[model samples]
Target: MSNKNINRLFEALTPTTEQNEKMFQNILAQSQNENTRRRGFAPVKRARSVVLAAVLMVCLTTTAFAAAYTGLDKTFLKFLSPVNNEQAEYLSNGAYMVDKQVANENGSLTIKQVIGDSNLTYILMNFTAPEGTVLNAARYRFGDSMITTDQDYQSIGFKVLDDGNPVDNKISLVMNIMTKNSIAGQTVNFRFKDLQAADPLPGIFETVIPGSWETAFKLDFKEYSNLYQIDQNITMFGYEALLNTISVSPISISLKIQSRSLKEINEAAGRLKEIGQNKYSDNYPITINYKDGSSETTSIFTGLHLLDYLNDQMLTIKTFEHVINDKEIASIVFFDKEIALN
Candidate 1:
């Protein structure tokens, strides 16, 4: 078949919005069922396991959409759906690629590319196990926590690389980190302690392989990101917040804001706190508006209260979902206010 025909076939197999949501709910359910085992570790692994299972199932049922994204180095394709031309155009601009490798007795890991801004860092890598080990459908559970040089940044989780069919003794993965400060020109040390591979089970992930993978690399955030100073203030949840900075990259956008009135502990200390219900407002919506009259929004906000007793200042970081061309943005709408960017 011709390349154009092949692309059409893959696009046809792509899941719709409802189908994607159903798959997401299934992944969530699987993760919840195994929450007992995922308490101490990061919540990303459970999600990854279910995603791997779902992807496997989809590949088996649908012809082979993975083949469409074979040579593309962008890791975003692995997570986002409907690999259409528009999505490809968003990531068409090449990233600063890296070819660093680290190995030990168990296996060798090669860092393919590094992309990020000050607020987030994404590492694209592939791992190759020793002769006897088979890594097909393998997921790792870390014994100790994954740490970085900057105490402010923490590893969110691992994203499995999509390579159509699982290759024997080989697996691709993406390491994502949420940063409290800029990681530009900073060396990050990664230690995957007591690494154990999960057995090829249906839902639950049982450890079968035991080992560790360690590597360190420096990040040049300036190479991939553009930092913009927004010194704007907006009020939300009955409190005022100062939008300090916004950083943009090819893969994501990160925002940092501060609020002095947002107290760490409210006076309603007697009642049990409600979960998943934002009573102050229906939802704290953060949107990124593009010049073309389109926008993207995310409600997930990470708020860190600092010096509550002394100054009562709260710091929050919001990471947007869509990959964008930073230069094309017209403004950013925080709640009701739209702060113009250009």
Candidate 2:
């Protein structure tokens, strides 16, 4: 494949209509938490001040912005989806419309929501320590809570945020998990162990959080299946790339693309560098074209990073998942306008 071929491929890209743009924009905002900040603890005395500040934010942005957004207006989850070089094969395409809060022996834990696809499950939750409990005492870790289904499952990274520093002792987290099973709509266990802080740890926040806050429950969630499939090949900058799989659900979409060799990717990157092209690091420029002629310009949140290009011939495939579910999409315009998979 030559550069001429790549340019020709991208030239065939299609643009979308107007009305459908809003829908995709909303999805981008919701899923990416574009301008939303973390919901920290706010004291009543500070209520007025907070309200004023919020008002300013709304004024600067828009009234509709302030009125909208839920706890689902999260940022960490987006970062978690693809922090390092990992690819998320499947993620929950569930709307951020879940509120599963329950009380435990030591405190209360809210199962904010659960989302996943056939390959992985992401459980988001908030833990409130018992009254008069100073967090940071213990690590407040969750024991093995991966669902024990016929398929294999394992825990990845357990993240806990103490809102803003240590305000009202409310912590939020998105548990990173992976499994080789299809455990959707199945009752799975959610077990979190108590945190014993105030230990000799070498990280941030070295304080004791009093509590035996153990939370356990059976959570039921729905997993999305990508109904439409498209597999095609395009040689970009002399690299033969395979657009392996594309699955779209009501809430999210996933794309699995592979390349033949890493050398080609390296060469392609070099060529882009030579041409002064911007890098595709944090975000991907993707446009979803629906059947209604309305198209959405949203971003692509990455997941797991498959095989290495150097050691293996397989190229690193970018995983796509973001919050957006609306009318059925007809095709997608991507690869710098190089390809359109209908």
Candidate 3:
């Protein structure tokens, strides 16, 4: 379709008020009446227009209902939905119902408060878990957790930490966990804090499963914050005996701040190149230091990139030192050249 027609269709699809729905219904009724009135007297061309208009109305109605249904489904699926024979049995035997009643009766899971500043946001949650269930760990990601374990279902409580406390009302999070067998259970009473400046760039957070019980996760917060001025951090708490079961620790946190501009990183790269050329030699080690405390020393011909130069008959530079300014913020280092010995 033409761009203008597509834009018009989008505008029409946007919901404005209840009057729009009423008008659509009226149009539909009128079209039906017209079809019936012309059942025996209309020309073929006029009949085709009426039929096309009726079809368009039906299409609009279908699109509206589909959008509404999708939203409702998403809301329902966000919470803990029963999954497996074990969970179903628990629900059937009135375990979940009893837990809900207890939660309602005690009223212990209440929103404590929310706090935030210009650069940070925080929400504090205080609640207790049910009997037989202990919170093993809590993690926040840009999306849902990839944990697939039965122990997640046994979680009873959760706490979320932020760069700063929220300044407004408390934010609520509906906690859900997956068991070892890939079963998910829902528990409420978790707190949520949306940081205003915490935006991770694309492809920064990558998860690599090293073993059955251990996963290596890497976060390039420096590279991420380079794209935006927002600073973000992740704080995780491990709980119960499951903490020992996993390879990681009790509490692990990572902080990335928007401290340096893109120009600073480029300047550092340029300085490294100049130092590398001046110190290049056949058998001497090259060392470069920045005003900041950060430094890297590596053999020019021994690292991963050296394999690509095996066929070249050039002098094999083997060692070098690099130094750059270290700001209180995050930084990225790019090796400009291999170190050589004189």
Best by TM-score: 1
Q: What is the Å distance of residue 161 in model 2 from its true position?
A: 9.4
Q: Tell me the alpha-carbon RMSD of every candidate.
A: 19.6, 17.9, 21.5
| TM-score, cand. 2 vs. native | 0.45
Residue-level lDDT tens digits of model 1 in 178-297: 666657677877777554555443344545555666777777434345677887877665566677776666555656566665552233212323345432211344687888898876
TM-score-superior candidate, 2 or 3? 2
Q: Give the candidates in order of TM-score, highest first.
A: 1, 2, 3
**Candidate-wise lDDT, in order:** 0.58, 0.48, 0.27
- lDDT of candidate 3 over 1-342, digit per residue (tens): 233432343345465557555656777577668768877676767766776676567668867754443221111122213233232222222211111111332123433322111111122233333343332222322122233222322222222332122332222332322112112131223222221111233223322111111122111111101112222221111111100110100011111212223233223323322225323222112233333544433333220111112221111112112101222213322123221111
lDDT (Cα, tens digit) per residue for candidate 2, span 49-102: 544554455344543332232223243335333211112222222433456666
Q: What is the alpha-carbon lDDT for the whole of candidate 3? A: 0.27
lDDT, model 1, position 227: 74
Return model 1's CA RMSD, one decimal: 19.6
Where's the lowest-lDDT run of ten residues in candidate 1? Answer: 264-273
Separately for all candidates shown, the number of backbone clashes (residues 3 or more apart, or on different chains) is: 0, 23, 30
